[model samples]
Target: MEWHNWSGSVSAQPRTIARPRNESELRAAILATPRVRVRGAGHSFMPLCETDGTLIDMSDYDAPIEIAADRASAWVPAGWSLARLTETLWKEGVSLINQGDVNPQSLAGATATGTHGTGKDLGSLSTQVIAFELMLADGSLVVCDAEHHPDLFQAQRLSLGLFGVATRIRINVLPAYYLEERVEARPLGEMAERWQELAAATRHFEFFVFPYADTVIFKSLHPIAGEDEMPHSTDIDERPFRVACELGRKANFLIPPLQRLMMRLSSKPSRRVGPAWQIFPGERTIRFEEMEYELPRADGIPTLLEAIGYIRRKKLPVAFPFEFRLVAGDDIWMSPFNRGVGSSISFHQYARMPWRALFAEIEPVLRGANGRPHWAKRHTLGPDQVHALYPKTGDFLKVRAEVDPAGKFVNADLARLFGIERK
Candidate 1:
């Protein structure tokens, strides 16, 4: 069966794709093959799910959400999409601690890959995990938390789909709340100097800047006082942006002007009020290939500006605006933000166009700032760089060896990335 990601950038023709409706079936599917990989919503840009062997499709799995007695957290089904999970949680009067710009990714996929949203003090979804129920390659299920199997739990927080297949995840939650999304135009220079202040002042703050533009779109999501009549929002129509991307794909020369023009047209301030789950993500229809870097808090803006400066000076025609956000640090062994706070910079290009050279040139700027790539995103990091950037690689590899020494969970991409033999 041919399987591809949402953006159609990565494709795989697996020999078998099994949709397991329950844990027993899932185990059977896993044990039936020498090699296996889970297929989430396929939001990852890299070939994390590319497998020539069995591919376990978890979309059919539907375990009940067991809310903790105190309601501070819940045991959520690992395969549920963020869209499904967050909406279901909302019905239960709870919501995820935070979510990224889109919600179609699976709960396990998002947490495993260190996916995150923007907040000065809030860590990524991986940090929200208090425990995990993982099925080992031998089909045995083990539950690990901070107090039980802590080493395994630490590595599982951002396991990158290596340690095992997460069957259930215990994550932190917040009582249902409302958020106000405010987007306005601001000068890049002013923002560069004070973005940290902006981040500290809001519940979530992020900004988008075109490589050649001097202004940025500042978006902040903050809690609203009460649930009242939601204010009307003049959301910028996305159709024009799609058209611009198509134009840029055909004639790269127009990308610079198109971006600046769109920035001008998109300058109008907009406001909307909705549930936290609804407000956290926006509609993302335009497809683009992305490479994201997680840098130290102090280096994020500097790295972004340097890359943008290079883009302008080189007259590189990048289609999408750069997204910059802040994420708090965590202790997850494989997480990019493990040691300290992070500044996340996402570089995107219309997938229809050439990107090898573009990202090739820009990635060094990020790397030079001591930035680490999100495991799921596109990057040229080899095994050496992986070990150098993530000092915990040795520890994680040790855990993987202990749990699945036969390498049942190792796919081609992962085997090469982690220097593990494909068994």
Candidate 2:
């Protein structure tokens, strides 16, 4: 079967591409393949579920979600993209308790990798999952929650779908509400002082600091008191299509130095206010490679500032601001943000630009802060380093061995990184 990824960055000729209409079909498909991997929207940058084996496309099973009246929780298909799910929940007088920057990811894809959004009060998307239905390697159905099969449930939340296929999820929700977003462009020093309060006060807050300049854009989302107004700003330069054009003009065919120069000049700040969905996820059509690490919240600003200093002194032409956001720690054994109050730090560079030099430059800061890289983003930490980052790494590996003893779910990449075959 032909192979293609959602990002189109990585693809291979898979043995087969299976579109299973239901659980039985899915199980049969998995059983047919010597090895299998699940594919959703393919939003991930890293090759989490990539394999030359059979690929399961969960996109065909989209259906209406059933939710409790309190807006507390609901069950949804693993195939549903965040955009459709959030919009549908709003129409039902409810909304997802948390969201990430991109809404194109499938529910299982996002939660499996611990994809998160910024909000001090809110946690990563996986934290809201009260229970999840898994189709094990043996083609057996299992319902995992805090009560039954708790260890499996905890490990499965952000395990990169290593144990089994996630068929459905029961998630926590919130009342459908509007957010009053505020964006400010200010000096970096000022942002450092207000960072803690900013994270604590706003429902969601994130800031981007451009290199070669002190200018930083800070965004905060708060609940609206009265009736919310319609979003008016359509002509913003930061819109996805325009940004894509800008990046194409700068980096597409040009040399790395030229791209750097363009980025240095293009660094600017802007603001917006609107609904939660509108404000939370922006149009990021411009494709750039990203590397993100989750550090303790207490060390967030310091780690960010240290990296900023390194870039400035080294004369690295970083076109974008250092992106920073927070997520409450979860109980997921494999989740990087499971420790508590995780602060995510992301580095962005044009795909054509050489990354080894830049990644080497930033690796020290992450190491010093005891950071853990996001599973779905770019990183080169080996299994030993990954084990050092998560206290429960051994336990998670044990669970994976028990659930998939034959290694039917394993790929070369996962096998090497996780040591699944040996354990």
Candidate 3:
């Protein structure tokens, strides 16, 4: 059988696929294959999970969530999806500090890729991990945390599943809370001018700017001291937007007009009060190929403007909105936001439409701004480029070697990513 990622951008026909129901099974599978790649929910757009070797699917490892007595942390199954984990946490009267717009990604997958939510004070998902239980390529289980195996902890937090298979993850969480979500529209110029001020004013803030239109949709999520109320409506309905994307995909010339119409018809302000988890993620029904880059917070607006200008000048047939967000930095060696405060600019195109040329043209603008591509998104960077952008690349490589000396987990893409010669 063949396997494809969520966006269908990457596919693989593994020599063998294993559905490991327990650690014993997982360890056996790992030891049996010379090359292995663990797959979570398959949300990544990159070939990180693609391998002609063995593919270990951990979804069947349905372990129960273990909450700490103090309610400050929880040990969760790494295979659980964000939606499942957050829902369980809510029932336990705790919640993750932050989360991205979509919730289908697995916990290990999200952290491995440094997936993040929008907030000036919040770091990426990897930062929330307190510890990890991994099965090394030799089929030995090791527990790593800030205190035990500190270097391994830092590298494993965002290791791209290159170090080992994370079986369990301990995450720091907060008491369950309510959040008030507000969304409104504004001109792109005005929003960009006041981006910092606006971001600082809210607990979570992000915006989406239509490619051909001047309109921007501003979204803010802040904690509120009140009982949760059932939201009257979802934050944003994607059905209409999905239809617009389909139309834009079919008729390239109609993209601009479709974008204008969608922005005009969907600019109404909306507010909703709900549990933090419920309010954090928005609806995403449309399938699209995405490319996101994390740049110095100061370079966000200028880089975004340059991307928009380039798109307009090229008359690219793009209709999906450009997503802009802020993220706090962490010390994880492989995290894109490892260098202090950062801002992310994301570009998307309907899955059926060609995105390579469009992304290829805009990648230079992002790279010129000293940006690092998100690990799970579409990116063209290879080993040399990656090393140039991430100063700690050697450190991560050292840890990878120590953990998987035989290169049992190194696939073709991983080999190129770390500049390793396959034995």
Listed per model in order, the count of residue pairs whose N, CA or C atoms clash below 3 Å is: 0, 1, 0
Models 1 onward score TM values of 0.97, 0.90, 0.97
lDDT of 1 by residue, 19-43 (tens): 9898899889998888899989888
Candidate models: Cα lDDT each = 0.88, 0.76, 0.88
lDDT of 3 at 59: 74
In model 1, state the lDDT of residue 291. 95
Worst 10 residues of 2 by lDDT: 253-262
Compose the digit string of candidate 3's lDDT tens values, residues 341-422: 9999999878888889889889989988899999999998889998888899999989989988888878888888879887
Query: Which residue pairs clash within candidate 2?
Result: 209-321
Clashes of 1: 0
TM-score of decoy 3: 0.97
lDDT of 3: 0.88
lDDT of 1 at 339: 81
Q: Candidate 3 — which pairs collide?
A: none
lDDT for residue 192 in candidate 2, whole number 0-100: 87
